[model samples]
Target chain A: MSEPDGGTVGKAMTVLDQVANFGRPVRFSELLKDSDFPKATLFRLVQTLTQQRLLTYDNQAQTYLPGLRLVQLAHAAWAQSSLATVAAPYLDELAHKFGEAVHLAQLENGQVLFIDKRQSVYRFDTLAQTGQVAPAYCTGVGKAILAFMAPMERDHALRQQAFVGYTPTTHGAPDSLLQELDAIRASGVAYDREEHERGIISIAAPIMSDDTNVLGAVSIATSTSRHTIESLDRFEAVLRSTAAQIGSAARVWRAPMPANPSYGNSGGENS
Target chain B: MSEPDGGTVGKAMTVLDQVANFGRPVRFSELLKDSDFPKATLFRLVQTLTQQRLLTYDNQAQTYLPGLRLVQLAHAAWAQSSLATVAAPYLDELAHKFGEAVHLAQLENGQVLFIDKRQSVYRFDTLAQTGQVAPAYCTGVGKAILAFMAPMERDHALRQQAFVGYTPTTHGAPDSLLQELDAIRASGVAYDREEHERGIISIAAPIMSDDTNVLGAVSIATSTSRHTIESLDRFEAVLRSTAAQIGSAARVWRAPMPANPSYGNSGGENS
Candidate 1:
């Protein structure tokens, strides 16, 4: 992973990441063991973060966890910037219509970041949750967005892909993934075919602002026990419609803002 | 709100809060107009935040929104640290049982910060969403937790409250709220009675560790059209039971960790 180079703020954020990645109340010692910074510097950073309410210090546990402030800020992030808020009603509609899980995602730093999800009431265990991230080359949503991205942007995204074979059907190289992208462009949809995880399959469609600018992707995911890859084709029409609706809603939402010359018209990449 | 006081990290976080509070794609000029920091300092902070991916710069719109990294970190925060994850299944059960919206929240910096929510299929317009914050003096979950808090902590929390009359039922002073807290302590439940919102009412129970340390609060909320304040009594039994179960689950989840002297045994207030 590339380390942030924004000085003190960056260092503090990295420390925050270390605590969060542990996914449990982590000790300063445990963080120090894995961190690049020296003990004193790390200690001060953690202290500062705790003071800022970005890292909560568990008194009884003597460990650190990501703070409640993140939850507050994240709420704002989801409501304000994410396609999740715009896509919510549509996701609910799609999920209720099909009785299948629906996921809405956008590319963040060349990976697919799930911004929202609606689990089928029938299915209790869902692979994706809001805020989960997955490889851009393997997942249906990832591939759908990739297929719709501009060539220069697509190549940049592809270069970042590790191409790890997560399953037998997973793409193993850029060439293989690129081939699938071509097929997706033709079909206007992408299929996971259990590429990212065993028994999980999804049909995904890109949510685009126009012909070239990809906003995000939406997918209806299910287990192999429920549907075969060919059988998943039944959801194509509704899924595409939902994607288009979200895309249009998103476009209208952004239409009020004037375009900036510094960054082109495409919403291809955001930093 | 008190600004963070941890130097550069604090400044960056303040800038982040400014961006997030806008709840839209905000321009630097708009941020500068409302900011306490001078233009150069604010500009540097925003640039640093964008680089660190704590803030995303929209290329086309030439605006900033809280970054996707926050969503990722907040996911980890929610799963690992927030009571929301532990309380999710119980919230689901409560929501399903009553066919009403259930909210899980914790006290953060003297405010009620909703960490998770389960919206009833029967009710779509929920008053609280995960990550939303409200005054601890007015809301059901807020009052429930505050009633069970230690005097010192409760006083501190009370001081932070503005006592704004969101509705006529909202407590106008600490003395009035304290009297109600006493009643809540005796009843082992708190009722909103449309205090925070005119048409909405809720029954709440505090999730406590032992008899002293309050973990958080859970509430089942609905419109007054559906149930009167007296009618909400039917949900009290289940609500209390759910709170107990969550408290137990939370205790078990924290049992293995040793206490630190820097803070104390209580999980009452966290940074």
Candidate 2:
């Protein structure tokens, strides 16, 4: 067993997570309403976090946001934990070769997190900021990784999906998404047919470890005006080959995966 | 006053910071040598941090590195605290205009921290990675920001410099560096004359808020082989103007700076 007050640290981290969920500066009262802790305890915890620089207080708006130390630490994590570090050359190559925007994404707690991106030398605007998350049910990279996951893990991740309908073509329920996943599994690729946003499309492939475990996904995204769905199919072989190369390179280059102490043997080796 | 046990959280943070300082995975014994904590206390703290996923243990190497959750949190920090968000368009404009590598940097613990970078289309090998740290005395961005800092803050920052000679032209003491900062303050720009590393030369200017407080610094880095120091002077007016635009743009954008409770009234209003 850990220290008696170890749970206090957990509680403090929960508060930190809640603030990050907001994606913008939040007032103390706003945080208080959503947090489970009592007002006095929450106040003390926030004060301590502020003192630690884990949370910064803006005296002007009287709001709290994530601090710079997290950014410094995250840069280290990005260089190590994610595919961004290992796949940089591949991503640069794909971006230059295809002349399309390239995306590198990983699964974090069942959500699709965009870890890195290479903007097309040409300009087109969309909201895929490096840290931003998107629905697993409608995006190409999300579907590609989900298609390759072990059945139990895939089911668990599917259950976490919001299935919010952003466009009329969006998958509004699990059944429709499940049908697509089967096709994706057979083809070893996934497509986004303006399902998340109108006029946006992508072809994604899962990057797999040499052990055949899914590591992450890579995609070439473009506006519908540039390429039709049939034309997009031309990238399938090259896209999958790029993903495989990145995966194989990553497998040989990075450190061995560690077992999750909390999950014991039940947690798979992949995260 | 903060809680007496605030030191407990501080101690835990020290353990976290120690892992980050390594830049790569580190074994427990390696950390122990540099750590002030008793063996047992450090062990308990490491266990707690591992449980929290603030540090991930690589079982194969038996080393610890930063975890994914920290990256997720840092993404939030990078979006808010650093100039990455507000300066994106400005950075893009500068890169296209100068066709040179552009850097956005801020002072962290009296050292220069590169928060964002846009590489030149041409090739040159250098150590300017985003999220990388460098000494304050011999770099362009470092001197640019240092010249604008409040006197006490600047002096404290100066005391932190190692005064290590990286090259024959490098500043080896505070007196010479102080003289350069005076000229920088007057000229509104700073230059790195093959100081930190041979062949790496740059011209930099500080980004200031509407109140004329230094927010960060921006620079155009080039190799001495590519351009002479006098030829680099041609970018001076444009570089300063770009820095001014980013400063003014950052002024209207982002959250208000937080007051450092430790520094009392002397910490100033700009973050």
Candidate that scores best on DockQ: 1
Q: Write the residue-wise lDDT of candidate 1 on A107-199 in tens digits.
A: 988999999998877765657888888898999999999999999988889999998989999989898888889999999999999998999
Q: Score candidate 1 by TM-score against the native.
A: 0.94
Clashing pairs in 1: none
Docking class of 1: medium
lDDT (Cα, tens digit) per residue for candidate 2, span B1-271: 2332445666777788888888777888889999878899898888777777788876645779887778777777778774778888888888899888999999877789888888887867568877778998899999999999978889999999999999999999999999999999999999999999899899999999854478889999999889888888989998899899988787667535443333334344332
Tell me model 2's lDDT, rounded to 2 decimals.
0.83
Per-residue lDDT for A163 in model 2? 90
Candidate 2, DockQ to 2 decimals? 0.43
Model 2: runs farther than 4 Å from truth?
A: A1-6, A255-271, B1-8, B28-34, B38-44, B57-63, B254-271
Candidate 2 lDDT, tens digit per residue, A182-264? Answer: 99999999999998989999999999986547978999998998998889888888898999999988876763443333323
